[model samples]
Target: MTEQVPVTSEMATPRRRKVFTIGAALIVLLLLLAAGTTFLWSRWTHSISNDAFVDAYLINVSPQVAGDIVEVYVREQQRVEAGQLLALIDPTPYQREVALLEAARDVATAALEKSKSELAFLEEDVPLAIAISERRLQIARDRLAEMESALLMVTRDVENGVRAASFQVEAAKAAVVLSEEDYVRYGALYEDRSATERRFEVATKSFEQARAQLEASRARLGQAEAQRQRVPITEHQRDAARGAVEEAERQVEVARLRRIEVDVKRRAVVEHRRKVTEAERAIELAATEVEYTRIVAPYDGIIARKWRHLGDYAQRGEPLFSMYDPDFVFVTCHLGEDKLDGVAPGNRVSIQLEAYGEPFEGRVLWLGSATGANFSLLPRDLSSGEFTYVIQRVPTRILVDRDERWPLLIPGLSATVRIDHGPGDPQWVEEGLRWEDRAAHLSERARD
Candidate 1:
């Protein structure tokens, strides 16, 4: 019973048959591989790490003008719309400046009106003075003419007296001749004792009387000449006439000057009016600046951060709060250098976020404008000074096109990226991730 019969040869026979069957199965499997060829080919694609969080475009909110924070109308994480006021600044200083400008404008307007009145008075005075001066000058000319006429009359009378004196001299000469002849005849008679001696004496006395009348006529002529010599009554009337003429001329000149002055004053009024207008405009401008101090949302968005509150000092150009537009949010990711090869805008991309299970569809909005080497705080400039040949990563901007289901898509999320190389791929990449299926079905569970 203990002789277990050395059955090693019998065992070897079954083992050989089993080996032959195994080898034949392997040959058939190999022949099937050689006879058939199937490929699961697809389009070239790329992917990026993704998360579903609330997304919004960010902008630093600050006031154009600086002032104390008067009131804050919004809180952190608050939703806002376009033209909605978010904060307010103290407007006291701007109000005072506007008030002062308005007062200055009023003063300028009053001064302009007063200048116009003064110009009007001057215009009236000049014309009146000119008329008065003309009247006075005319009177002087008339008086001068009267004096000339009087002088001419006096000259005529003097000439008449001279002619009468000459006539009397001739008459006296004739009478004296006649008296002498008579005396001679009488004396002859007396000498002949036919006439008396007294008759001869009377004849001689008559001749003497005739000569005296001639001399008296000549003396009257001399008196008339002396009276006519004082013709122009002391050059005062002529001087007065000249003065009146000069006054008339000066008044005319004054009138002209006043006209010019009026024009200048009118121009001055216009200039002041323009200044007043400008001051009023400046007041409006300053008021607008005060309005600008109250921050307003440019579009519907959410507040990402609030750096200041009421009573907090905010400097000019300093960001007091931050906001973003949810309608324009984009996903940003960094791609390795090797992965970035041949990548361009419009390339398809998929992202896996923190909370979301699987990848999401996106289009490459743009490649980073500058390499990562140039965008860092201490950018690696490999061109100089201990150059390194390390792989460089570039940030790619992708626009997510999925429906708004969950609110976990947010900005500033970390991600990993993958790309696809399908069969028969062309060089240029395309936008959006192409999936194994076309339906944009919910894959929250399938992603895991």
Candidate 2:
């Protein structure tokens, strides 16, 4: 303008052409930017974070029991299988415990055998005692019956003797009365010279003889009654029989008590055997652990972490080495909420890494239950003061199936993901920004 130079048509055309090319380039760039907006948008976007990574399952091996580490079977990054050995623990104490349990079991078994033998002896002796008791009881009953019969007979004899004595006493009384009357009459006659003195004396002698016979019969009756009362029931034999029965019953009870004791001892033996078996099982378990000390690859994998080294002291459950299954690798992508539209579980995905420009084909396998920000160790506290809204991300698991084994991809690798939710809605990056509005804002911003 200061030179006031005249502009030729050719020159003007060239300048105009330059501006048009610039504008066209800018428009293309804008379109690209618009498409990229879906990746970071709240809906219908497929933006990937620069912090994306490839993750995989890792086995963190630990011992079930505590012990000093005796040997390690695997190195820092050795692969292992389900039953493969990883390390070994010191087994001396465990082996000793097993031996002790075995000894205890043997002792218990011997005690049980002795108990069985004692039981057998009691079984044999108890029946014999019982039989003896039964015989004695029966004999006692029979003898008691015989004694009762004899007692009755003796009682009858005494009664008869008493009756005989009573009859003699009455006869004696009659004879005395007759003799006295005759004596009195003869004495009076004699005195009157009507009877003889010798007749009086003869009547007196007859009465005295009858009285003596009555005394003798009474003495005999007394002796018989005393003898009957002196007789004992069963002649004292039943006492012995009853004593034998009681002794036999007590012996049987003692045998039963012994039998119960023997059963308890036998149970103790069984318990000991069980303990021995458990100890052996423990030894086997320890031996298995020792076998694991020679850890080997369960499958083809790489060493991810090594927490122990040669000659290092290790306790049980201490991490020694970490291994990863190279073939089981997958990328866990956290897709923004807006980008999750129509993203079904079986939707196809494309994965790209800065390291590798080529894309990998994968499928969506899972969806996370919550957002990463929600699970953060320390979340921002905005509910107390500010109206702060956060964009939440949902994790989507995508499994790469194009390759049978996972490639050189490792866990915590950066990657980008693209999801084709079937001809998605219009991209919104271009909706708000008109060229004229942008120009005005630029002029205002330039002035500031």
Candidate 3:
């Protein structure tokens, strides 16, 4: 091929050494530049923390009622929607309780209705009976008044008749006495021929008539005296009427007492109504228990673990499954305190997960108020004056932006986050622009 030239060892060594020295100097220069750039980029633009991991809200699903598990409808790592059925407990006992309480409620309600009807009837009937008794009492009083008035009239009539009969008897007696004297005188005159036979006969006939009139007057007086007996009879009738009025008043009092019975019945109705209400409450509680038998998901999530199985007995408040919402995931970073000077909420971030090669876009969510060491189980005590100053890290949260590759991020994954708090182009962008310019220059020289 090419022409070959022979050289001495010293000349060859110096030339080789110069080439080697230039190569080493170029490498050293490159390394120093890279180091300086990295230092400047980190100090001026961003804060980095490797102590970061993905976090989410983990929920443990539990049952609210105790029973035997009748069915299990999910498994570990299964995706579920809100209100999806997870499992079922035995509902027969709860159903039976509800049915029993419902029947009791119906019975109590019926009893309440009966009591109400009885109260209504009494409300109408009792007042009517009282009115009837009062009416009877009024009628009896009126009758007594009539009887007393009649008795007074009869007594007056009897007294007047007796007085008139006595006067008539006295007049009749005088007439009899005078007539007898006249008859005797006429008889003597007839014997002495001073009077005729007709005169004597007239005197005797006059005496007979006067005597009969006296007997008739005496019979009238006796009849008038008998009329006094009617007074006692009228008094007896009036007394009987007064007794009737008293009896009617007693009946009215008895009827009014029946109102107490109505009050008692009303109380019974109230008691029955209370029983019905209690039974209804029991039924409602039982129905709620029955609904508790069906275990449904509270939100859309993925089941992380299944703690119970079919036919297993689960107590109240026992864990049935553990799940988490993947859509609400974020990263928690423990950043050194000195590096948080420019870091703040809403700053841009780049996250690199250990499981993936590409970086994810994120934004600063919030910063923790206390360092991680403050939440330790046994925090170091500094009051004893024996202390070593150590750098503390503050917990910071970064919200990852959702993308097509979001599903690959899981909780507890280790990640390295770079939080950009500066307001200019990043170091990588400037370096890329410089390299592009150099490449263009080289291309132009080649073309020339």
Best by lDDT: 3
lDDT of 3 at 158: 93
Instruction: Write the residue-wise lDDT of candidate 2 on 194-215 in tens digits.
Output: 7677876676676567567667
Best by TM-score: 3
Candidate 2 local Cα displacement, residue 404, angstroms = 7.5
Candidate 3: regions farther than 4 A off: 1-9, 12-19, 22-26, 170-214, 334-339, 368-395, 422-448
Task: State residue 439's C-alpha deviation in candidate 3, in Å.
Answer: 50
Error of 1 at 326 (Å): 0.7
Worst 10-residue stretch by lDDT in candidate 1?
439-448
The lDDT-based order of candidates, best leading, equals 3, 1, 2
Measured on C-alpha atoms, candidate 2 has an lDDT of 0.63
lDDT winner, 2 or 3:
3
Assess candidate 3 and give its TM-score to the true structure: 0.79
lDDT of every model, 2 decimals: 0.67, 0.63, 0.88
**On residues 1-448, what C-alpha lDDT tens digit does candidate 1 reach at each position?**
5866676887799999999999999999877665543222221243323322323346678777788998999998899987799988887888888888889889988887887787787678766766776676677667667655666776676677777767776787787788778877888898998887788788778867766766776676677566555545424455655666677667666755666776787787788778878988998998887787778876667788998899886777778888766555567666666666556666665666655577666666566766677767997665667865786767666667667643556666555444343232223223233321211221211111
